[model samples]
Target: MIEFLLTLAILAGINVLLACGFNLILGYGGLVSVAQPVFYAIGAYSSALLSMKLGLPVPLAMVLGALIAAIASFGLSLPSLRVSGDYLVIASMGFQLGIIHIINNVEFTGAASGLSGIVSAIESPWRSQIYAGTIIAICAVTILAIRWLVTGPYGRAITAMRNDEEVFASLGRDAVHIKVTLFAVGSGIAGLAGGLYAHYFLFLTPDQYGIFSSATLLTMVVVGGAATVRGPVLGAIFLTVLPEAIRFLNLPIAVMAPLQGVIFTGLVILFLFVKPEGLFGSKSGGGLDAWQSRAMSSSMRKGAK
Candidate 1:
């Protein structure tokens, strides 16, 4: 039982890393970039190829992989910024499909066979506790780091851009730079998650990351409530463990997938109906007490023009 619980905890932390990283783009910067999984795949493949093929140390390879993903994100940003809303989503979907095709067809990435036998951060069977502790520590550190980031000057700029990009630009703040930076940083976070996931699973595969996975991450950010620090983490943990809990239902593995689909769809619909802002987002959810919701609503009504 302890062993099983530990596995759940580790997966939960990973989901937080993935969700929060993408939150920087969707929630804070309002960039709505749907290609997060592309960077994630890039990170995983880079790490896997380096570790398995080139025989590099795990940590170094992961960092390098993340950097490569960042560069790729920067490339994606240039053509993407001019497009926004649903149009931007369509372009991002195209990019994702194109990238997945390249990944599956390319020899360097093991083509459709996928990459396997990668290393993990955990070192020993007896040291499972230590491994779990290390992962939890990383998650805690990330939480603090995000808190610091969201409360600082950078946070102000992001919130401003989220509320009003053109107005922010008119105020002499470069909205384009902020938007692009948010997208890149978000991708970097996704890359980091990818690296961790690759090491955790000891394998890499193109199908593991696709449009649906990207949508999952995006759903966490959106339904978790963008513009709030706690939402993504809360949502991540819930979604990560939700399936694990469902696993104990004693259904066949094939039946399990459909059950999960139904569960996720229901959760999404319920979240949208009750607290469209997210379960833990906004001070109204459980934080400060103010008329912020009214203010947000008023701003939206006026900004529609």
Candidate 2:
């Protein structure tokens, strides 16, 4: 029971990290990216191969994996500057499919059979607790770092761009740069989460990081209340544990698998209809928007004075 619970906790932590990245892009940047899983795959594969094949230390490999993802994000961003909304989503989906194909065909990636024997930084018996703790600590640091970023000048700029890119442009702000930067940062976060996931499981499979995983992460961000810090974390925990809780029903594998999907999809649809802003999110706007509004109001008051 303890082991099961520990596994749940670790998965929740990873999902939280994933959801946070989605939140930054979809929630704050107002960019809908369907290619997140591709970046995640890249991270996992890069980290695993580096550690397993190249003998690099786990931490260094993880960092490099994240960096590679961030760099890849720039490629997506260039195209994004040309289109947005549904078109951007389609482009992202294309990228996702393309990457999956590459992973499946690439020999070094184990050609769809998946890669195994990934060495965990934390060794056995104590591995579970230590890994869970490390992930939690990483999540905490990420949350704080993201909070700081979203409250600063860049956050305000991105908020302006999200609300009205034309207005932001009229104010002489470079909306393109902000969007690209946020997208890269979000991808980097996803990559970091992927690295952790690879090491935790000590295995890699192309199928594991497919469109379904992207949908799940996106669902986490949406259900948790996209722009808020606590929303994704809460959503990740709920979704991660909810599936395990359902298993206690002892339903057949066929029945159980579809049932979990049905439950999760129903909840997401319900949330979309009932509270689109999410549990912790504001109906008015995201955290960035709130800060921007306050700043503008204060300036206006001073001008009046």
Give each model a TM-score: 0.89, 0.91
Q: Which numbered prediction scores highest in lDDT against the true structure? A: 2
- The lDDT for every candidate, in the order shown, is 0.76, 0.83
What does the lDDT read for residue 165 in candidate 1?
66
Model 2 lDDT tens row, 1-305: 78888888998998898888878887788787778888888888888889989999999999999999889898788888888767988999888888888899989888789888887877778888999999999999999998998889888777778766766898999988888888888899889988999998888888877788878887787777777878888888888888678888889999999999898888877877887766677766643343355456657767978
Tell how far residue 169 is off in model 2, in angstroms: 1.5
- Collision pairs in model 1: none
Record all residue pairs in model 2 with backbone atoms less than 3 Å apart, i.e. clashing: none
Which portions of model 2 show Cα errors greater than 4 Å? 286-305
TM-score (C-alpha) between model 1 and the true structure: 0.89
Clashes of 2: 0
lDDT of 1 at 139: 72
Residue 147 miss distance in model 1 (angstroms): 1.6
